[model samples]
Each structure stands twice: as structure tokens, then as C-alpha cells.
Target chain A: MTIPNEISGSINNIRPMSQSANRLMNIVADPEYDCQDIIDVVAMDAVLTAKLLRMVNSVAFGLRVPIDTVARAVPYLGERMIVGVSLGLCASHLYNKPLTGYESEEGALWTHCLRAAIAAREIARYANDKTILDVTYTGGVMHDIGKSVISIYLEGSPRKIVQGADSGKFTDYIEGERQILGTDHCEVGAAVAAHWRLPASLTAVVRHHHEPGNSPQEHRALAYAVHLGEFVAMMGGTGTGADTLMYRIDENYKDYISISAKELELVVFNTGQEYEKIVSAMFDGQETAF
Target chain B: MKTILLGVGDLGVTNKPGEELQAQSLGAGVAVIVADSRTGCIGMDHIALPDSTVSLRRAEEKPGYFADTGIAALLEAMKVFGSNISEGGMIVKLVGGANVMDPNSTFNIGRRNVQAVKEVLWKYGLGPVAEDVGGRVNRTVTVESITGKIRISAPGREAWEL
Candidate 1:
């Protein structure tokens, strides 16, 4: 079992500049940057603008009228949502690559991440925690970023580690990673989050989403949001991979969110519909050489 | 010797005087039995996974699709029986919460079924006086009607009282 050099090098060299860079550049490049200015920047990147427009028209928004341009999408999606979508789309490139360890094919993680993000967003909205919705979306998308890095590190050994973890030969998946790859995905993801200087809230979610009990109360809520989101996504069959078993919903955290068991079910039910809308809108309109 | 079989979505209690009783199961399954001087209530529930909690709402919408609501419904029946046999003080014995599904999956409906039972009992203010839950092994539980003794059976394991 050996790590693939190409994957390892790409992961090691991963700088946080992709989406955050674009957002920051737009913000700093124009101190007085408004939604239109942001739209202008997105429009210059035809591919990105088109993706943004498609997202605005997606069923998640349930827009009364069709949105045709980045400028028209601004008010409908709002500035923050546009930024979040852009960030989410930009990060997809990283997860789009193939990995040997998991059951799903290339880009499966990205699809799961996106569904979790959308689910988190809806959960936050339904719970009336608007302030945390964007953060939750970002956090959910990045929560499993560690898995990607870990997969890269264990390119050849993923199967062995997975087998050990499945057999309970290892105490937990993290231990399996340590045995095979020198370090686990959680640690690498935390490092990646830190490197990106994403909000402390999101970084904490990435670090502790897998183990919400250990996280601080503030971060734990975010972790719970992502945890429930992941659970719903997995149950809905969005990411039915070998690692699906590793995704646990911490029952204790149920006390933190306003969502009751019934409400959570409704959110999960709604999430399946939303997932279809977003995937179709995001993917159906685009064609790229992979 | 008197034994009451509690079927799924149903609750039964032994109320007859001077009866030594036990709650027993043949394979991997869950049964909750409560005894009083006048009556004994026993109920059985089966859930898809041991750890995945299903809401009553989900159960109501899909009626028999989930086990949590069935257990809850059984608990309601037990409460009615408990009232009917109020003359006898209630003593509870419980079993079930096995990983009946793919162990590798995180969603364990069996464990969730047990949790749901606990929650329903807690809500009804008649919590399990004693219980067994969660393991690879299957269980058979029995409770005495008069003395309130519980005997649990499993392979290669001696019968134990709770």
C-alpha cells in the first residue's frame, strides 16, 4: 500500500486561494464593492457566472421567474449566498478527483458534501438560525475535506484501512488512518481549514464534526448541524459509500438545536427534493472536460 | 407457571394471583414486560436498525414503516393495562436493542428502537425498572408474575435474574 505521488503532491500543495481568493480579491479590489460589482467580477468568468445563474434558477430558490444573468441573480440569492455558492463550486474541483478507498466513484464526496451543505442550510433556516446558515453551508461542505486528504495520503492503503475499520480490528477509522497513513483525515482537514483561515466556526466544524461531543458548545452546534445534515444526506442515498457507516448523528446534540425528531425528519425529507434540484441545476447546464 | 407473549404493537399483563411468571423470546427480538399483583403487561417491538431513531411523525406518515411509533403505541397500551391493574404495584423488566441490520452501517434502527422505548416509558412516567440492550447476541427475557423476578436467556450464557 503506497500513496500516489500525483495525488499527494496536489494535496500537499493545496493553497486555500481558489474560492476564498476570488471572494477576497473581489472584496479588496473594490472597497465599495456592491452586489453588482461582485456580479461583474463573476460575469467576467463566463463559466462561474453561468453556474451562479443556474443555481439561482434551481428549485432550492423556487424563484417566481427565471434568472438569466449574474446581475439578476444577486438580489434573488443575496450577496452572501452567491459568495457561498461560488466558494462551494470552487472547492468542488478538489473533491472531483478519483480516490481508491471509498466505494463511490470520483466526485461522490463532492456530491455528498453539497447535499450536506444544502441540508444544513435548510435546517438552519427552519430552526431560525439565519446568522449561522452560511457558516453551516460552508462547514458542511468542508467537514469531510479531511477524508479527501486522508484518501490521497492512503492512496493504496485505503482498502486495507477500510477493511480493518469495517472488521472493528481498529478502535475507530481515525486509528486505521494513523496505522496506514501516519495521520488521519481529521487532523489533515483541521490543518487545511487552518491554512485556509476559514472562519473559526467552520474550522471547528471541520475538526470536530466527526466527534461533536468533544467540541466546545459554540462549535458543537455547528458540528451538530453538519452531523445531522450528513446523516440526512446519507440516509437519502446521496453518498452510499463504505464510509457511510462512519457517519453518526450524535443524539446528545439534539438538545442544542430547536429541531425535534419530527422536525429533523421533515428537514431530511425536504432535503431529498432540494438535492435533486441543486444537482440538476448545477450539473445539467454545464459541460467540462474532466 | 404462566407466560404472556407480547406481540408487536400489543401489550399484555399478567394479573392473576399466585403466579410465578417469566418473559421469554426464542430469537433476537425485544419485549417489555411489567408485572403487578393484579396484572402483568408484556409487549414486543421490532425496528429496522438498533441505533437509528425514527420519529413518531415519520411513523404516523408511514404507519408501519418504522418501529419507534409501534413501540410508543405499545407503551400507551401498557399504560392502560397498568391503570386497569392498579391494585398491584408495577414492576418492569425489559429486553431488546440488537444490531439486526448491517453492523457496518451507522444507522442502527435497533438501538433507536430501544431508545424510543426508554423515551416513551419516561414520557409515560413508568420507566423500565431494569433492561438489557445492544450487543451481537440475541436475548430471551422472562419475569415472574408474583415475585417480580426477571430471567433472561441467551446461548451459552446462564439464565440471570434482574
Candidate 2:
């Protein structure tokens, strides 16, 4: 498959985010949005409603009893998480499909994405910023969206890409990709986010996750949080591909995060457990909605 | 085969021959302990830090969590398993302890972990026969007691026995 080198040229080449997801994302980001409003929106889409219930019931969330209704499920899955499920479900086709660009197997990227989202939200909570939880989650979930595009447009041996990308000398994985693929996944992911017209925060996070230090000034913290989330996931052995530890970690992170390593260590372990539950619930190799 | 999972600062041993011991995220800060073929028992731990590396004021209760303590615990367990280094038959192998961080970073935890494990092994007078350690990739190691095969693998790479 030939991948277009230019972002504009690749617009029609990849799958686009669903329209309903786009609409719900706007409503979900608003704090004033009522839970019932979300319930109504989801209630309209029977397919999303069903998938949301299935995801909540999956071992990931660990519900005691099956939640059959979107209203009842809406409470269990908060507004932000419900949006995550919706985005996950709507973009399920893109996230679910296997990408050969990275060392991951089928569904590995999807699992890693969910794990990163969970980690990002947990980090935000740890940092005492409960408001940006949803945005951070979205950022974490979509950080590697560009890799999917690169996988399709890949021109040479996957192993060679892994080797070139695995070198720690580069500033970030994208630099290696740019050297090898002309245009890296971060740029592609950012372009995709722009094309989809999702939030600027999401687009910036995608573009600068590998090098969050260089992200837009306003979205720096979100980028850092997403970067940490991805790092934690890699450390936990989820979604760890050939480029596991190749990227640069902001040494000054300790300045940003005051939490002790011991505490973060436990969170890493806990996140791994949560990742297992959520990954199993996510795209199970079957190309169905949920 | 019973698979014993090792989390950070966690350790496990397989007494019976049918058991398989493994650790999924073996990076620079993590180290795996393999059972010597002589005893048909494998003991593994996820050592987060070596006492030799840094002096911590906080009390570390879990022996499996530290390099020195983890090795001490493993040595004690091996004694109970009827494997003596002096008498022979305590062959060993080490996997992981990779410096997955940027090469220039001051915090090369994988090298530190490997150093700590080495010191402990020296104290016990045992050395690893084979090792696949210190790289940028995460490694998974499986010590199968029944077949006496130790499989080392990473993503996109096929498993090879040590």
C-alpha cells in the first residue's frame, strides 16, 4: 500500500471519525451538559447504546450486574467515560484494525490506546485537576492515531522501521519516522484530528506527544500528561512495540509531578490490571461496533 | 504449566517440575531470577532498586522489591530447594535489566538492576550461564522447569531458548 507523503493528500486515504461521535464529543466536553442529555443522545443511537452497555458490563469496568439501559449505564460510565466509549466505538474501525507499522500484534495499539487513556485520566486525578480528565483521556487514547496512517502508507520492511525507530538518539519517534517515512505518524495523527475537526487539544496532543516539550504553549500540560500516560503504559508492558523506550522523557517531569515514585509504581501496576480488563473488552478482533 | 507472574517488587518460585515462571515487563529497573536446572525449581523477582545503587531512608518491607533483598530471599529459597552452589548443579540465567531509556540519560536503571543482581549472585558464588540483557526493548522471559528450557522473547522477535 502506498501512503501519501503529504498531510493534505492523505485526507481521503484514511478512515474518518463518525459524524455522531463528532457531535457527541462537543456535548461531552461541556461541563454544564446534563447526564440525562448524554443519556438521551446515546439513547437515540441504539447501536452506541448497546455497545456502551456491553463495554460497561465487560470485565474492564467490572459491573456486578448487567446494565441493559443507557440511562442506568450512563451513571455507571460517567459523562467523560461515556464519551470515551462512544469515540472508541465510532472510531472502532480505525483503532481495531491491526497496524503493521509498529511491533504490536492485532488489537495491540487499541489496547495500548485505552491503557494510555486510563493512565492519563489517573494522572490528571493524581495531579488534582479533575476538570481536564476527559480531555486528557482523549489525548491519551489518540496519541498514536498517526501510526495507523503510517502503517497503511508504509513503503519498506517493518523490521527496518523498528530498527531505525528503536534508536534512542532521535528526539522522538516521529523524527525517525520522518527520516524513514517522509512524514511521521504524529503529523499524520494531527492532520487526521484536524480533518475530523475534533478539539484542538486533541490534535495538538497527537502531534506533539512524542515531543510534548515542543507542543503548543497552551496545550503543554495536556501533552505532558499524555506523554506520561504513554510512558507508564510502556513501562507496564502494554502496547510496548519496537520503539518502547526510544523516545525522550522530560527529565523535568519531577518538577511538574510531585508524586513519589513508590506511589506512581503502584499506579503503574494498577493500571496494568485495569488495562487487561479494558483491553479484553475493547475491539476483540471481530470488526463489530463495540 | 503453572505461570507465576512477577510484578515490581514481587517474587515467586516453582517447586514442582510442571510449573512455568515468567515476568512480562522486564526493563532496566526490573530483573528476572531463573531457576538453576539442578533443582528443577525457578525463583523470580521484579527488583525495582538495588541497595548498592541508592540509599533510601524509607523502610522497604518487601524483599522482592529490592535488588539486595530479592537476591537474599532467592538464595534462601534455593537452599531450601536442595540446590547448593558448592556441591554443583545451581546453573543460572539472567534476562532483562535493559537500559530502555535514552542512552544519555543519567538514570540507566537497567544497568543498575543488573549491577545489583550481579553483586548478589557474587555473594552466593553463582553466575548466569546465559544472559540477554541491557537493550532498549522490553523482554519477557519464561523458565519452564519441566522441559528445562528458558525462552526469551520480545515483540516482533521469535522466542529463543537460553
Candidate 3:
């Protein structure tokens, strides 16, 4: 009998971020990095430097004076903000990938990730550890890596997946994926992260985000943040998908971050507004047909 | 046919024959309160979250955002399309308020939206003849004005008349 490999094959096909882009990612992720370090890394890519400068000058960033150089943008927007823009640019295709089985329209996943990333940043601010900001943002954006990888395998059985997600019985989406394919998207996503040689902690965030209760203690916080971020996106209605309500919200997440209900609603509202702004700036208000 | 897209907290009415009215991707905390003239007119509102824990007095400030105010606003808009509320010829249909959130969460806003809508409709002496409420799916509702037919569909599922 011959064995068919799906998860590993999807991982192999994924193009990792460019070397300079990866370096920029690390530089921005670390709080120790300074303006010069950010300028140094971003200056290496002419395209990225120009794009970054143009972005900071755009009305979306609320900058009155135009940013003519990477150094100015680095200081103006900060390294963390720069890294976020860089991730969206370098891995734009990853978020833009068409997952017919998972999402209802094109760019639906990207909208979700953008909002989730912003939401993750908001939730991480409330965490006890301030160092997880970059990781939490990265984890939030890449949390659904597995959905794209496993999308093709489930294309034929989307009805079953939707039915399972819409069952309204607190059904676990991962379990539904397992029933359709021998492997689930989370396991596939983690393997892809490993193949990309991403940080183990990041891999943990993608792997355990759906089931934060089972995640390792060290990685649980990021997982919890990402998990909550997903809820914020779905509830806010940006990334409309078949699995919109299929996922579960961890009740203990409030215990982890200590967010009040009023505050949560406010955050969701602010995030939705921000999502529209980001989408307008990036996609030019181009939404895929629903 | 003219079509109107209802965003959250938005309401509209159209009597133009063959015109279509739609609301897409309503979450658990959201509701789509619809009233059809049963001829060539339709009205709908995509009401956003309405917290039952909050009193009606406090929530009434922005009635369009919550179910109580949103449903009232939608019904009021129907008069422009020749809907007679007192005559009870209006056929009401509720298409959203799905419990798409995790059951374990502290709040079940979707169920609350449905509850508030039902209660408000009862007070108005208006009840839905058709309701496709409560599930995990993000419903897309379409109302055809000419025939007064509504169809709701989710991704990867067949669209059916409601």
C-alpha cells in the first residue's frame, strides 16, 4: 500500500519569507532593537523601504509630514509597527491564498487575519508579560495557516464541514476536519511552521490556539490571546467564512487577560473600524464576492 | 430591480417591483428584522449587538443598534412602502440571531437578540410567520420585493426560500 502525504506536501510548497524580510521580522520583534537597526534592515530592500515610506505618509497613518526615508518611518511608526507592515507585504500571498473550503469569498481570510492581528495586539497589552507583543501579533496573523494548507483536501466536502460548523451544538472544527481528512489543519499548520523554521513558540501558538486549554504552559498565553483574537474578528464580522461560529471561545481567557465585557465590546468596535481602515489602505476596499 | 445592502445598525425599505434587499454575514449578536408588504415592498434592518444585561432605558439611546430599537425602526420604515401595521397584513420574517458563538462563553448575545426581537414583536402585536434563527452559520438573507420571497443561505450550502 502506498501512503499519500498531504500536510508535508503543503508545507513544502509554501515559500518562506525572504532572508532580509526574516531579519527585519526578528529585529522588529525584539524590543532591544533601535531605530538604526530597523533602518539598517529595511534599507536592504529598496521595494520595502519605498513602500514603508509611502505607507507612513499615507492618511491612514495620520502623518501630516511625509516620511522621505526609512529612518524617519522607523522612528515615526516604531519598529513593531514596521514589522507588522512588513509581514503583510512579504507574506501577502499567504494571507491572500484562496481557501475555497474554509472561506466564503476571496480575501476573507486576509481580512480576518488583519483584524485578528490587531485584536491580538490589544489583548496582549493586558497580559502580565509585555514581551509577547510581537509574537502574539505574528501568531494571530498566522493562526489559520493550516486552513489554507488543508483547504484543497476538503474542497469536495465543504457541505459537510459547513454542516458541522453550523450544527450549533458547540462542535469542534478540528474534529470535523479530522473526520474528513486523516489529519487536521492545526497539526498541518504546526508542521508547516516547523518546515518554515519559525520559532517553536510561534508553532505552539498556531497549534494550540483552537484548544488553548491543552497548550503547554509556556505557550498558553499567546495561544489564549490568539484564540480570543479570532473571536473578536468573527464577532466583528470582517472575515466572514463558513466556520464563522464553528470555533469555541475559552471562558478562562478573561482570567488570563482580565478584560471586562464593556471593554471587550469597545475593543471589538475599535478593531472593526481599524480593520476597515487597513483594508481600505491595503486592498483599496476590494472585497471578494460573498 | 434595486438592491440595498444593510450594514449592522442599518435599515431600509423599498416598494419598487423586482427590487431586492439583502443583509449578509450576520453574527450571533446581530439580527435581521424583516417586514414584507406581501406584494411589492420589503423592509429590513441589520441590528447589531443588544445586551439584555443592560436595561432598555440605557439601550434605547441608540435604538437602531439593538434589537428593541432596531425592530421598531424597521417596522416604522415599512410604512413608507405602504405597510399597514395595525391592519396586520404585514408578513414579518426573522432571518438571523444564530448562536454562532461558543456555548461556554459568559454571554450568548445571539439568543438575547432573538429574545428581544420576539418580545418587541409581541408588544407590537406582530409575530414572524417564518424564522430561521439559532445556529452557528453566518446567514445571508435576500428578499425579493415583487413576489415577497426571502431566501437565506450560508457558505457551501444550498440557498432555500424562507
The prediction achieving the highest lDDT against the true structure is 3
Q: Estimate each model's TM-score.
A: 0.56, 0.77, 0.83
Q: Report the candidate with higher TM-score, 2 versus 3.
A: 3
Residues A1-290 of candidate 3 have per-residue lDDT tens digits of: 11138557767888987776677656644646565876787888887887777666766677677779887776666665566667667776766677777655666776777788888877787776667776777787778877777787778676776666557432667667787787777788887777767776778888888888778887788888888887777766655366776776777776577676556655655565566665555543234311
Docking class of 3: acceptable
Please give the distance, in angstroms, between residue B128's alpha carbon in candidate 1 and its true position after superposition.
30
Off by over 4 Å in 3: A1-4, A28-40, A52-81, A125-131, A164-170, A285-290, B36-39, B51-64, B72-76, B79-88, B100-104, B119-127
Evaluation by TM-score, superior candidate among 1 and 3:
3
Interface root mean square deviation of every model, in Å?
11.6, 4.3, 2.9
Q: Point out where model 1 deviates above 4 Å.
A: A1-11, A19-46, A54-66, A74-81, A125-130, A156-159, A285-290, B1-162
Best by DockQ: 3
Across residues A1-290, which tens digit of lDDT does each residue of candidate 1 receive? 33345545555677665654455334522325555666766777766777777677766677888989878787776665566557666666667765545544677777778778878776776443445665677677778887766664565554565556557786545677768666666667777776676666777788787677777766676677777677666544455244544433466654555665455545654665556655666665455211
Per-candidate DockQ values are 0.03, 0.29, 0.39
Sorted by TM-score (best first), the order is 3, 2, 1
- The superposed Cα distance between candidate 2 and the true structure at residue A175, in angstroms, equals 2.3
Candidate order by decreasing lDDT? 3, 2, 1
Question: Per-residue lDDT of A1-290 in model 2, one digit per residue for the tens?
Answer: 23354645766566667766877766655545566777788889888887777777877666788889988876666666677778877776677777766666666677778878888777766554445666888788788887766765563444555555555445555566776767777878888888788887788899888778888766777787888788777755666366666666776545444455445545554565566655566544435435
Ranking by DockQ: 3, 2, 1
The pairs that clash in candidate 3 are none
Model 2 misplacement above 4 A: A1-10, A28-34, A59-64, A126-131, A165-172, A280-289, B1-31, B43-92, B97-131, B144-149, B156-162
